[model samples]
Target: MIKVLIADDQELIRQSLQIVLNSRQDMTVTDVAADGQEVIRCVRKNVPDVILMDVRMPKMDGVQCTKIIKESYPQIKIIILTTFDDDEYVYNALKYGASGYMLKGVSMDELVGAITTVYNGWAMINPDIAAKVLRFFSQMAQADDTISVREKDMEELTRTEWKIIAQVEKGASNKEIAKNLNLSEGTVRNYLSTILNKLDLRDRTQLAIWAVQTNVRKRVET
Candidate 1:
């Protein structure tokens, strides 16, 4: 079973998440925290596979907590769950190695899928925030050194893999990519896995960033 820790300052939100997530057959809510400090303490006591972390909290906040947790325990996947999609928060959370970023308004199914995706070593970002994320990386890619390094790393991808990466750079889901490429969903997933392996990326989030940094999407368009 995938163990999850829900961290939100609001009691109602925390309790609601715990109840909903705990109802899943494949997951269990190991604990809940009202703030970032408590989240760290709980993680140290009983490490969870995934953490649903709210961006705003009483102390430390989710961004700082993510940095500290990822620094100390890189294996644990963290999903930033928040009502706000502030650009700084999104950029900082991703910079700090968060596995996913999702809004609280998402359905329970999406939440579960995000958790599962992260646990399985893939990244998940809400579609609404995807554009901001892409733009964030695009701006950062203006650095010549970073672009050169990412371009060098991207050379290993095959033509088909490049197509897949282009789709990912657009924030297309696996299903959408499969439909667009006229391949089965399993095939798309397999290609994504191979792409991640070839690029030495941890998950799709890194792959997307690399795609933007290396101009894979622009090349595909042109």
Candidate 2:
């Protein structure tokens, strides 16, 4: 079964999530936290497979909590659950290694599906949020001249790494890349870390942006 941790400040929200998730045959709520600090504590104790995290929390906040979780427990996937859809929050959450971004108002069915989706090595986002993410990327691409790609770093990637980079450039998350390449998700994540380190990029978001700026994906076509 997929072990999950629900972290939110509101009692109602936590109870609602626990109810929705516990009803699933393939998943269970192992723990719940009222705030970000409690989230870290629960994680250290339960070591859940996935964490449903709220962005705004008293004491530690979800963004910082996510960063710490990703750094310390790299295997644990996190889905950002929030009522706010601000660009900065979304971008920073992605930057910090969130596997999914979903608004809190999503239906219980959708939430269950999203948790399953992330567990199976895929990224999930609310459809409406995805549209916003696309628009954000489009605008970033239009302002391209401002973002620079280092030529020396670009030259350092191997052919396989380049192939992986092309997938990431297409906004394919680690899971999507694994599916497309017929590789394991762990392998995709390893490749992603190598790519990030080699390219001196921060995360998949930066890697995607750099891919567009450098036209790395074009190399695949030609």
Candidate 3:
């Protein structure tokens, strides 16, 4: 069973998601929270496998909550449930390690499928907002060319690491990356960490943005 947590400031959304998600055979709502702080509390106690988080909860907001949850529970996957207008929040949420985001208008089946997908360690982007999300990532790529990062860092990555980075650019998680590169998830994680350290990037989101800007796969081909 995929243990799930629902966090939305609106009571109706929290209840609606809980009722619908619990009816699914493969999922159970372990906790429901009405704010970001409560979301943290529930997660600390229950340690759910997947979290459906609202983007604008009071007290902490989904972006900060996602960051804290990921920092404390790297194994837990979060799906930001939003109304699909907060571009900055969406970018930061994904940057902080959310597996993906879904508009609240998504059909229950889609939401359920997303839970299963993230539980399987894959990112789940809603097609409705994919273009907007990609634009946000592209902005991240172009918005700060003057940032302190050194371009020479790419030269330090091994070909295997380049392959892993290519997967990240496609929003593939460690499990998907491992399958793509014929390596274990542990090996992918290790390589990813090394790559991040070498590039001085913050997380997979940044690495993915860099990959898009640089097309690191070409390095592997060369």
CA lDDT, every model vs. true structure: 0.87, 0.80, 0.82
Residues 77-159, candidate 2, lDDT per residue (tens digit)? 89998765566776677767887888888888888888887776656767666546645655667773335657897788888
lDDT: which is higher, 2 or 3?
A: 3
User: What is candidate 3's lDDT per residue for 111-137, written digit by digit as tens?
Assistant: 888898778766677766766776777
TM-score against native, each model: 0.93, 0.67, 0.71
Sorted on lDDT, highest at the top, how do the candidates line up? 1, 3, 2
Deviating ranges (above 4 Å) for candidate 2: 135-222
Candidate 1 versus truth, CA RMSD in Å, comes to: 1.9
**What's the lDDT of the predicted structure labeled candidate 1?**
0.87
lDDT (Cα, tens digit) per residue for candidate 1, span 153-174:
5677788888999999898889
| Candidate 3 backbone overlaps, count | 0
Q: List the residue pairs that clash in candidate 2.
A: none
User: Candidate 1, which segments miss by more than 4 Å at Cα?
Assistant: 143-153
Best first by TM-score, ranked:
1, 3, 2
